[model samples]
Target: MQSISELLKFLTGTVFAAMPRDMLRELVLPHGHVALLSRRRADMIISRVRMVAGLFAVLTPLWIVIDLLVFSWPVTGLLVAGRLVTTVAFGMLAVSFRKSIRMREAYKALAMMFGIPTLFFIYSHPLLSHFDMAGPAAAIAAGYAFLPFVMIAGLAVFPLTATESAVFAMPVLCAEALVALLQLDMLNWSSHLGAFWLLFLIATVAALAGMSQLSFMMSLVRQATHDGLTGCFSRTSGEELLDIQFHIASRSGAPLSVVFLDIDNFKKVNDTYGHDAGDRVLRTMTEKLRSNLRSGDVLLRWGGEEFVILLPNASGATATSAVTRLRDIGLGTRPDGDPVTASFGIAERIADGVTDWHQLVEIADQRMYEAKMAGKNRLVGCADPIQYEAVVNA
Candidate 1:
């Protein structure tokens, strides 16, 4: 029984080991693990979409010359009309692109980017099929058939999840299939099937490439945003988050809370036990705080022995109650085997009437100083500090 259990364990471990460990949940799901990561990724995707759309806008109208030269009269007119509409749509999308574009808007922009060409392909293929032309005209008309392939291959340019890539590629696939169905009388079933099979292969490869880009993007974001010591967000990323959350709260009329926490006498731990022991205490405290806080709450390492927690949609009273419970439970143990403690300062956007996130952080920092002066290991908020002198004195 023991040998069989061991074999099972080994097999499971081997299977997991072969899988890409760093391919986060975001690689498979359309959404990211954190809102901030999703927002950043959206901004990147929108920028690229805008650039590609702009290129299409410029290059699309120029194709009218080819239509005039290859085909004559009404066919040329119909093709030019379709090209104008597509060019106009691409132009509008490119000009409207902004850094603050949301994920929903990014997805919509990507769809439209692929969508414009698909519509053109559908409109032009039947027109082209009507003409039994030969030589260069035939070759130029054949180029229109490759539009779906080009669009599917374009998916490789952006960092998108497997789900997002599949979703975006679906419309183009349908468009190609629809055009093939319409042209069944002009072309044989075998030729159409072969073309579709090739398109599917290209789409599958493009989706895989997109997923690879997403994986690399995830790695870059994780390294850039998180602190090496505590695995908390760095101060730079924290500032960006504060600005984003604050604006969101202000717009929605929701409360945003900030908690400024500082370890008590942290220098002594480094002075006595060593920097390694101090590192352990920091890691332990981070684990305790993360285990206690809600998943939505963001923890940032502000500086040495200082951390900031952002609680979105949480009021001052809610933050006070939560942190009080945490205090009661205790943070963790120090190098000396004694209880580890911290001073906390809380500030809420609605309660403080702060105009900006900077003001909120400043208020919290000031109250943290008050906590330090009123005796350490206490929480100072909108009202008085939570006194722990009685317990300490005992």
Candidate 2:
């Protein structure tokens, strides 16, 4: 009998282990998990408002029908009040979420504010006698029903620290234990209902876990690919992307162009106004580049006071024209209210077998120096072989 019991335990443990963590998270976490994941707090607010609206849309008619059928005007009134309160809560939460996002506050503030009220409704509603559940069994079931919401809100508000998750798990486990105790007493043990709630809880937990993982992964990817200061692609990642574009253009026999830009007298700006102003200047330049470039073109911070623009499917002439326009636009503005300008060198991969993107960049860079030496705020092109040769000589 001892051996048989041990074997049964082993089998149960194995089955649990085989279940997907994502599935368990979805079962255990709340529906509001989607709201927590929004890139902006406004997005979260909009999502929450939609949820509240949807809930009211369904519950309002149901309450009306029940009131007419049972002739219970009081119950209908309570339902209306609940719906109104929920709507107001939704609106408040939305506003708070927006504020939190803008302020870059601890993410949990919105979650906690939204969650505490929800928990109160779940725990206190039945005790008011307007709702159906009254006994310990009802309390146990209600607690179980509220578990996912609490867990999800916790996830949104709290850092995904292991200690925090363990802390949150304690209350959930306690709720499940209470439900189990009620079932053991044979007082309100509906096996079907218990199984359904358990399944739902498991699913929610699994989903929350999955989303957390995905969010973390996305954050890492963004950090790796983007410049920390300007939010443009880093030089290495940009070059790799340009390489891929070059390969595609070569195969299609289409033109691929590069424009190298260097801020004229950038060091003077840094020396005169301090690094903060220099940073502001870089950010301003980035904004201009992002705004002026075509959707297909990519702008990258190549290095200090330097940027690279990749224009695919653009001829040498077209690339020169674009760079000239960029030079005009960039030089037109003074970020620090001081005189500023940029020199540009434009180049195009005109033939096949030029697989090395670095060579094109080097050619552009050389021409850019030529423009700077000849006169600042000028555009040079690879089409001028003699000029390039002179640039190389210089």
| Tens-digit lDDT string for candidate 2 (185-285) | 22355753664465445434533453454345335545777899998888877876776778778789899988888998898877988888888888878
In model 1, state the lDDT of residue 92.
92
CA lDDT of every candidate: 0.84, 0.58
Superposed model 2: Cα runs more than 4 Å off:
1-213, 351-353, 384-394
TM-score of each: 0.90, 0.45
Residue 120 in candidate 2 has what lDDT? Answer: 36
Q: Determine which window of 10 residues in candidate 2 has minimal summed lDDT.
A: 385-394
Residue 326 accuracy (lDDT) in model 1? 80
